[model samples]
Target: MLLPIALAVVALGACDTGGPQIPEPPGPEQPTTPSQPSTPQQPTTPTPPTTGTTGAAAPPGTIAYARGGAIRLVNADGSSDRALWQVPNASLAATIGGLAWRPDGTELAFSSDHEMATSWYERDIYVVSADGARLRRLTNAPALDALATFPKGTVTVRVQNLTGDAGPYFVYVLGAPAPQQVTIPAASSRALTFTNVADLGNVAQPVVVINGTNRWFGDAVADVQGGRSVDAGSLVVTAFGGIPHYGADVPFWRADGQRVGFIGSPTCNLMQVAATPPAGPSQSRLLDPAVFGATCAVDWGPTAATADQIVYVDERRFVDAGEVQFFRVAESARSAGSPLLTVGRYPRITDVRWLPDGSGFLFARTNDLLDQAVNIHEYVFATKAERQITNFTGSFVRQFSVSPDGQQIAFERVTDLKGPSDLWVVRRDGTGARLLVRDARAPAWNPRLR
Candidate 1:
């Protein structure tokens, strides 16, 4: 079954129609010359407009999107656009939701309708090459396939297979010929096993599982233990109470995957569990109640070696109303603190992604309450400089991705909810902004050597 999407509603209580606007920065004062004889005054050299120093300008790449049961590819500058692939009239009943580019940037994977009769209730994963040369179907089962994450060289998907009246589905890892189902053995019918796979390597390692009913959540990291040729896996269990919901609703994993963190409501208190050997019980620690006192959204930063940060939305009285904040996990661990820094604020932030070097991150920000005005902002941690890349007035942007080189960004912008959302790209310095793809939602940049 497809998961429910979260919606955020903003209510402005009081309005100040006569409030004064913020003034611009004052200009530099003019200097006066001496009365005595002086050398001829030299004209000041005008400064050239600054260009993005990150990379050399190259022909912008192409973007692929799905619209009306057909996949479309467009130039980065919003020109010479064409439909790359289209399904038959019978197969166009299901609406395509998620689309992702392969690590090689040569193929696209998406979830679309599997049948015309059951289009509304059934869906499957499909793949198409970048040039629209080849098409392939990955899954054929009756389960609802969603939340697909394509790692560097491998594709790891979260599949929720509907079984009878119960909703106990298993998450599986697929191989070349067949897919491997990973689950924890249960003792009784009441015992439901909840497992979250943190990271999967090419070699043998333990798969993490959270074993319990719906009351508590835990983490189990697997590793090689026994003399078996295929490495033996061990289980670690950590427990917590008052969990908001299951799946990706709450922030769990730390940057290094060594510890899991979460916040419980209606008090909005923070808790964390460290991964120990022999499956020890979870240790509960409460954070400052004031900082995490509001019901806010949380998300993990991009998984980079140097990127170690957790971002959340916070309310800062009247100044921010609703704003986004970032905290450094490394510093929090050193000082035994909850949060390290409070980054600047944005109107609305979604899908925060870090650059390859971990110097900054890119996120989608909407300025209006209706989410019609949207822009992409890059927040640099080191310099504390935030640059706005796009400024379309009535378009909403989603499914954003940053190039591995941290020079270019890709996203989907839609003018109306009933219309198609096209892909767009711009430089890091907010220059040379243009459209890339048409009618795509989820876009993932390739991290391989390009």
Candidate 2:
């Protein structure tokens, strides 16, 4: 969830005081609230399960959330809570937000406004391994950057020549730009990288033509994390390719993963960019209905079946309801005709997310068009049915995430709108709701189950 609102300053209490580096803040020794357990109403259904847990053991997966100046991870059952990172000096930094999990669920990325020296409001993207061991800052530009998305996985290809004679070998990632020819000396090797992702096609195929001869290697799935190698005996390598710039607010990975859809900065127009290109690259294109305010609430559908679909807030008005539009990707800049559907009309809108299987989507809207108490709702594509998922009498659902199995949802709820938020988890059917953590927001579920 990419909430563009300014980060509210919250004073921190005494943090760990000892070693050269301060330790991450710990999660509540116990769940801030008591547990509420329920049974699975329909265990066989593909929809979210209607059950909740109350176990002392850590649950099946991880849930990452944001507290004042820190990023914390907790279990679905509210156990094994711990912080991954915390701002060293709260006075110079804003709260950590925009939590996005890598497609493989090995790393988590987010944005923070802590580089006050560059600009009091500068925010940059950062990535941290799931274990919180390796952290890397990815961006340093002075901008209101947020919402960094990743594809299913990245691949690095290592090619070597086992042949007696030295010659040129051609390597290509199907559906990407083109093949590049590399000269390899006999018994020597070289590394090639590919953003082999679905955004370009149904799948990414990495192929290598040996020594410019009809003899070849590959047409292989680039699925491994370390990468595939073609050596004199076989090939090997690893590296993080940088993210492509496409004006950064609320960026999301297309169902295919390699391509990204984001709102362009300054103009607020919808834009698309490939995560990483070849040595040379093509320009990213901008799309229509320059978003109504800077909000540009947007999200990509989850599965390959819905790879080209997107749901976003395209219109806003002071005296009338704002429009949420559903669009399909096209080759042209403006795309074509009308939206496939007008997803909804609301006086105020915030976040939008798709179920893991692409059966439907969840969105946040003000109840009764009152624009005060916001709740999360579900929109099923097949039935064209809409149902309210969260009914907080006077509170708002700020940011929320669907579990990897699509059986649960974790969300941020605040009674005062601008007040400190509490994290809550509930069954997909809207039952068995419970507080998972207090004073936390931006709940992001790990993409894979543990």
Candidate whose lDDT is highest: 2
Which residue pairs show collisions in model 2? 162-232, 229-235, 230-234, 230-235, 231-234, 231-235
**Whole-structure CA lDDT of model 2:** 0.51
| 43-62: candidate 1 lDDT, tens digit per residue | 12211222222245553555
Among all windows of 10 consecutive residues in model 2, the one with the lowest summed lDDT is 16-25
lDDT of each: 0.39, 0.51
For candidate 2, write residues 190-237 as lDDT tens digits: 776655322222222334343311223322333222223321122421
Which portions of model 1 miss their true places by more than 4 Å?
1-57, 60-62, 72-90, 102-321, 327-346, 368-372, 417-419, 437-441, 448-450
TM-score for each predicted model, relative to the true structure? 0.43, 0.57
User: How many clashes (backbone N, Cα, C below 3 Å) per candidate?
Assistant: 3, 6
What's every prediction's RMSD, in angstroms?
16.5, 18.9
